[model samples]
Target: MTIQIRQFPCRRDNFGVIVHDDAGGPCVSIDAPEEGPIVAVLQREGWHLTHILTTHHHNDHTQANAALKARFGLEIIGPVRERERIPGLDRAVSGGDRIDLSGLEVEVIDTPGHTAGGISYYMPDEKLLFANDALFSLGCGRLFEGDAATMWASLQRLRSLPDDTMLYCGHEYTATNARFAIDVDPGNLLLQERVKEVEALRIEGKATVPVSLGREKRTNPFLRADDPGLAEAIGMAGADPVAVFAALRERRNGY
Candidate 1:
């Protein structure tokens, strides 16, 4: 079965993605940020909506859940930990739960950092990861609800995915993230080259998403907090990985 992915930008910086199984299976939206764009994509693609896989309960992510569910009668699935917060949530799932979207299988990964109940959807067949706000191209999400240790552990789960996995995040903050990355890891050749590429993409008004997990692991400082080189660069050599992660997050808050 061929899975079609349609990704579009909506709201201030949020992304809306739709995953479809073209072999007469289910078509699921990642997060319902708005009704209009999702409806537009459905109309353009001629695909029927079957479900909505929500990553978190943030308003920007779940605001349109009720409207879409009302229109299409979709099965809305979200994090069990925040089921009460998600609008129109039908099924509450946790990390180990596997969802069967027709013949396709979706792995639910708990990633509680940006929010206490944040989760990410990983499709092994497609090598697609709907990370939402947990992970980004050149950075990671801010600690809004969870603490440093929690967020750090959450990132490790994502980091364990295959290197070739394609990541789709919640926002278009790659440009800013690239700048911050360069400032923190000035001597990192991979990051330096990546910053140039990110600049060029932004210069032409293109989205810098769908970044590979391998590239992110090599450059994203938050994901690399345990690396001895990064630890020393930030004056935290030999520090615990969690401590290093905390310091990195603290600096990012100011950046």
Candidate 2:
């Protein structure tokens, strides 16, 4: 049995994802940006939603939680730190907690940067990560509720995963992220090549998500703060990795 993933556009730039396990078990919704799109997808696929895994309390991510719960009678799980803010939350989990989605084991990772209580779900058996807004393709989420250092730490934890892990983020901001990455890492051939690909994909009205962790490590500026070439390009050679990361993030905020 193979894990099946379905991704669709929602709202302005948000993405809605559904992950189905192969053993005929629970089907999980990564976020609830909107109800109509998700409900339509579920009906089309004949998949009964058994769980809703929320990354944070952000409205765009959890706005349809209550509706989905009411419609499907599914359990709502979210970050323990943000339990009060997550509507229809049935279970609250923090980092290092293992949640059993039917027979599948989903590891809850506390990723606090995009939001103070942001969480990510990693399915080690499938090498798939539902990162939501904490990390993005060629970019990391804005430091809305935490500092750069805090975000950097969260990224480090995700970076430690196997290079082959498939990262499914929350938005369709890859094109813009690629442009900013190239501006900061001009000397990186990998980054240059990737930007071209991203541009072509966006031109065709395609989604540029579920990117490999290996590709991100090589080209994403947010993930390459420790690289000597990137540090040098940013005129911060030999500086602490976290400081370099902070500088890159600050520059991106203005870009």
Number of backbone collisions per candidate, in order? 0, 0
- Over 20-43, each residue of candidate 1 has an lDDT whose tens digit, in order, gives 988999999999999999999999
Task: List, residue by residue over 1-255, the lDDT tens digit for candidate 2.
Answer: 467899999999999999887679989999899999999998998889999999999999999998999999999999999999999999999999999987878999989998999999999998999998988988999999999889999998999999999999999999989989988888889888999999999989889988899999899888878888889999999998999999988888998
> Cα lDDT of model 2 overall?
0.92
Instruction: State in Å the error of residue 138, model 2.
Output: 0.9
Question: Could you tell me how far off, in angstroms, the CA of residue 114 lies in candidate 1 after the best superposition?
Answer: 1.0
Estimate the TM-score of every prediction. 0.98, 0.98
Best by TM-score: 1
Q: Best lDDT goes to which candidate?
A: 1
Task: Report lDDT per candidate.
Answer: 0.93, 0.92
Q: Over 4 Å off in model 2, which ranges?
A: none
Worst 10 residues of 2 by lDDT: 19-28
For candidate 1, give the lDDT of residue 184.
Answer: 83
